[model samples]
Target: MLVGLRAMLCIVSIVAALPAHAGTLAFPSTGSMPVLSFSATVSAGRDTAPGTALSQAFGNAGLAVSGTDCTITQDISVNGTLVPGYTNVYQTGVPGIGVRFYITAGWNGGWTDASSSQFNKTDGGTAHYTRADLVVTGPVGGGTTSNLPSMFIKFTGSCIETVTATQTLTGSTSVTGNGCSLTTPTLAFTLPRAFSKNLPSIGATTGDTTLSLGLNCPAGVKVGITVTDAVNPANRSSSLSLAPGSSAAGVGVQIVNGATLVSFGPDSAVAGTVNQWIAGTSAGGAMQVPLTARYVRTSSKLVPGSVNGKATFTMSYQ
Candidate 1:
């Protein structure tokens, strides 16, 4: 009887040294993930209010946990530069705009602002085990912005499962209006005739002509310009197609601004348009954008009679 009693005591001690099973909390695979996205052409100029909403989206971002009862928590990290004077608003990649981010979390029972670079949400409990709608705001009129801010939120908790998860969201926007008034709305380029034998081969350019675009703008206005091919508005290539009625067959026109080949886009003053290039900011006076025009051989067989191409310009201001 004494030996049996000693053996039972040893078994109980070994069982006590084993580790206990823990719970976990994480973002669901298909549902409750944050969704913040926007794309629109807002009016050009400053917003009347600092936090004017350009767009917003609602999404249910909840966590999945193990066990019937559990405790969930979140740690916040901001990956953007916060705008001055505002806690939760950050600078959009766009120059003149700001973005606001927050969530009405189930565990907190109120709106939680994601303002600081590092923070904690230990108040989470069973109230957030299932669903929570996240709110993402895209505000405009602060400056010219090219891209909306991205979101990354992480969650951890004490549930039957022991795991950590994160949620991510992305966004975008466009701005439109009359940029600076064009003083030189029309520009004409005339190229001299080139001998086919003199041209070495296709892709060689000749007759470079220098030109300038003039504009009048208000003081402190940021300016951007876009050039579009008049013959084909959708042409995004550096070479311009010859306008109809041109007798020349194997040559095309090309324009350059400050060593960069100018690609064509649709005629629009919207900010962030393709090939939009920034001219210097205005100081309440006239500005001149210098450019160069040249003719390039587009085909191996040269048929030179008369080559003409037209292009249009659109300006945007912040």
Candidate 2:
């Protein structure tokens, strides 16, 4: 059984990348550029008024949406003429590259091509937004050099009641449009009020807590997890332990699936999988995999210090 000083539980997340095919949504319109990269700009706070514009650009700040009302202006541009239709750049996907931005997890309200400025020269186009995510396509109208266009990325959506992964940014980006899943950079389990508890007999019974993982992917996507060997890999059995500098003594954390201790192989290996799940269609809503973390008692007496462990969750997409 597990014991702790306080009653806090921190979930360790490690998403495995299992690439599959949903369809094709790549950039350049013609060829496939897998090594594409671009930084996003949320020029306003997530709490800004519904339709008002913010003063400046909040470069690469993460976003959290309550509904589809929290509004903001955003500018997403690639490094070079990545944005089709810049100068004589015609749309490879359509006519002139209008751009189609795909998001991880999902979004609340929906995005619209904020066409008020004379700079928004695209005569017509499409900016698609769903409860799952957003995609800005088109501007396949005529001649233009305006690569980076302004967008109205509002957070007023009606998908889930709380902050699910479908509405959070996972910092994972691709030049290709859609098809793959979108994820948040990290799934931080709330800080436990206390990390201390009573110690149960080894190989006996103890305590456990439930946790959530944020993943928004296409239909039929599979997920896997892994843990690093930063701790004592040889001394431990099938579970992982706390790294150096933990407050609790003779204690560690282990992920459990039912009764078995989930084996988290080396740091970044995705082959020897342990805990995993598949994403259902949108009819079922977003997929935030529920997991359990328990305190592993290694010492005879329950200490009065904290019991915390750290592991980097590297989310991979197929």
Candidate 3:
């Protein structure tokens, strides 16, 4: 009896010491439904090179991920209220939208396909399992009409079974170079006041500016950057845009995304869905992300008063 007790104690201790596979879900604002917590981790790419933002880096490197394994111990259903006609959805492998949930191999799980499907009841049929990912989709507005924030409380899709097990990451959780801040509080890109005068002709660009993003984080961690600032969110084109006030006329500004002009807003492409990053070196280095800023000439009715705008930014890491 004594020998048997000793063996049992050793086994229990071993399981207790293993890293836990647990995580959380975050909703941006109030009115969000209480989401069941899930395991979280950086992008699987992080498992590869430590600081390098793979070709999939959205902006900088750090992308917020729950983890490789996510389990929903309960049976729940949801649909979105952010917009009408387009809600309650999920898809496979980071499609830039939807709840993105799947089940994995484990005890007691049998799931139904979540493709374009809505759940109005406890998972019908036998219990199944799949790998899952609930991603941040763009809020509705301008050129985008999918996966609104309301999906948080109103989302319905694939589900995971609850089980007691250990799933430690084979990847190096060593994260570094993770602190990010805007070094340049303000950047003024130049658009010729005369360009406003051009009115519809689209005058030449007056000047340009680059905002610098400084990073310092755990060595192996990855980082990504996103621009949520735009004067007029409703007028976005996968980029940033300046809103048009009654006081100002004939011209609006647009932020440059690479060679193309992208509008600004929560739904714009400037959102941190792109997989790009400020990579770290083998020695756990640092990085500076440069954001290009310029003015796109919109409307021919150039009103040369005070041309001003602002945008807020955020950084994510895995």
Candidate 4:
């Protein structure tokens, strides 16, 4: 009877130990298992207003100003299933993932103003002006970060700004002495009061007046321009006062484009000739005209460079 009781106790103890051993085998006992995944998105943010005279002028000119904005978002996921031999692990074994987001912004602006005025038959005037600006903003060295794995991460970055300005002028004048009888008038050119005479100057009394033009480009951009006269000098004349019965007649100033004459008129005229030629009355007039040039980019490179060219004007008296 005692032996049987001992055997029964041993069997029960063995059965209890078997269950414990099976539980240990089903659970992971080695290293921790980690699984991670992450995703992010970047976008532009709102632009700030640029404060300057140039900005104000552009606004007055009906130009709408704009700037780029920046934004960033991130998501992270983690799972505790990366290890082998793990089956009955606890549901809360894995840790939550963390992430962060950041952003940056910058801006620039510029402009040019031009004007021309004719004073008399012997003098004229022209002027040009330009300006620019740039700006940047943000935390200089640090950015924001988020810790929540499921939420988007955001951070503000450093910003940059810049600006610039410029001015220019060109003027000319001409006079005819022989009234309407003469076919050409003496020409005079002047430089801006601030410009040095070391630059090229016009010395011809009767000929075409050529105006040199130049431009400064924006960063990463370049420009080039070509200008040609649209009128012929011989076919055009400037009108002037003339006495009745006088033979004086001709165009005053002429602008030519290729072989075609685009603009021409008389500046003065006389009624008669000298020494057996009937002396006629005299009339005088003057004009101020504005001209334009076209620019085109010849290369695809983004490096900036200046573009320069010239336009010609002819004055004729007959």
Candidate 5:
């Protein structure tokens, strides 16, 4: 009688351990969901328009939808509000930027907008629900974010969802901001006519002229400047090449910022470019930069005629 009672208790315990309701929805039996990652570059700071796609990745490719009489429904909810005119798009931590996860029913089925947090039929069966695409959009922000919880899905029915790694949304974006507005007059220099004997040797310099640059900047921005040789964009040397139409030969122009001789670089605002220097931090007011330009002999002989050189100034801010 004791053995029979013990056997009955063991059967009851086994039945209790079984799942009461099996889910019909299913994911992949092996492997894991793919990670969605992105890298983007934004010029002129948040200059990109909102909703512009930056990067994309496809996930869940190996996890085909399969189940007996699969009539499952999946509801979607994102961490942020939905963007208008965009399906399944949600805002990120940064302003003016958004992301989306577009899911499909597999086969030739169309993509479904999962943004509504409503359970919709998976249309499972031989359709083989295949994959989803993740997209990042603008206006992009600066810096990086990892493992962002962008989306969550809930399904109804018996499903075999795999125990997989986190479906993290990783992003890195670079942006440059508008620093200051600049104004400067066209600079010109006239040197007294000198005899070749007086301008004796090569490397001799003459024709010093003062230049002033006016800047209207916002407060707290650290401003830097670069001079680009108009004649040769790649020139990073102290000597600026003479532009065409100049009859002069064997002489080049040079600029001195305050007292330090200034070299030229590409006409770009990228930080750390060759010869870029911090001018000062702005106090949200008008500022002036004092500069000087002079001519230097490039060769042994100085041709008598015209001397002309052009340069463009670019500003960078931190």
Candidate 6:
């Protein structure tokens, strides 16, 4: 009787263990999901003239758009297979991704317009203006046990808008002497390193450190200047006297070294006719002169300290 009872108790114990093993077969599998994130920026190509609209003002300045508008996406997956001897199974989920863009616009007082005669009118040109916008989208996310997850339907691409302009001049003048001269001048400008925020190489150490001026003039006239840094040879030129009707003039500057060229202060020029036109009623008429400048840097090493530079202009008639 004792042996039979002991056998029955063993069988009961076996039945309990079978239920525990069967419960393991019903365990659920693991899973994973993808992740996603997004940003944008706006840039201008150059300075604009005053009175121009925001959209039309871009080309006036040399500011250009740089960078993209988008977001990030991530995803993950889990495998259901487990070792026969192990009871615990681990799983993960997919990640998400996305992107967007933004733009900023403003004035940069770093340019000027100078003419030869005071009677000739001068108009204050526009400062720099920039524009940026944002775009957002969703991307595909997927992964598996045998393959690494990938952004299957990723969002990507870019768009560009160019800026442009046209300028005109008009007026009349009178000359008491043989030669007549007019000067229409404005201030020169300087830009800080912060203006070039998008370019990584254009940091505090190697920022755009130089400004240039382009002067356009008529034949026989002379244009000269005194600068803190060495000016480009091509920028210096001869100025011309206004004919009885109208004429055009131009000049320019190229900033050198580690420093940048700022705007020109108030300036003027002298005018007198030479041998032939002395006693005649030589009416000096209306003329237009345009001046423009830009910033650039050399490929030399950036020093660890700050420095200073300057430029001055003076004109006289013979």
For each candidate, how many residue pairs have backbone atoms clashing (under 3 Å)?
Answer: 17, 32, 75, 56, 10, 82
Candidate 1 lDDT by residue in tens digits, 1-318 = 455443343444444564343544555553255555554455533312244455555555555444424444455555667666666676665544566666555453555654222223322333332112121233233334544444555554443343333334453455532246788888887777678865668888888888899998767667777899988888999899998889988888999897888888878655567888777777877988998999888888888688878888877675
Worst lDDT 10-window in candidate 2: 115-124
Model 6 RMSD in angstroms: 29.6
Tens digits of lDDT, candidate 6, 1-318: 455443343443444343211111000111111121111122111111112111111222222223322221111112233222322221112111111111112224332221111111112332322221111111112221121112111111222122222111111111111122434443354534322332224212223333333333333323333322223222232211112222211212233322323333223222221111111121234333333333332223323222222344433311
lDDT of each: 0.61, 0.36, 0.36, 0.20, 0.60, 0.23
Error of 1 at 108 (Å): 13
What TM-score would each prediction reach against the true structure?
0.50, 0.35, 0.37, 0.14, 0.48, 0.19
Worst 10 residues of 5 by lDDT: 126-135
lDDT by residue (1-318, candidate 5, tens digit) is 455443343444434476534343444543334566655654332333344455555565343444333444555565656555665666554554566666554344666654322233433533323232323344334444333445555544454342222344656554334456776545555655655665577878777888678888767666788999998999988999999998988888889888899989888665566788878877887888888988788888779778878888887764
Higher-scoring candidate on lDDT, 1 or 3: 1
Shift of residue 187 alpha carbon in model 5, Å: 3.6
- Best first by TM-score, ranked: 1, 5, 3, 2, 6, 4
Top lDDT: which candidate number?
1
The positional error of residue 234 in candidate 6, measured at the CA in angstroms, is 17
Report residue 252 deviation for candidate 4 (angstroms): 30
RMSD of 5: 15.5
Stretches of candidate 6 exceeding 4 Å from the true structure:
1-186, 192-283, 303-309, 316-318
lDDT of 2 at 30: 29
Q: Give the clashing pairs for model 5.
A: 22-158, 23-157, 23-158, 23-159, 24-157, 24-158, 24-159, 25-158, 25-159, 45-176
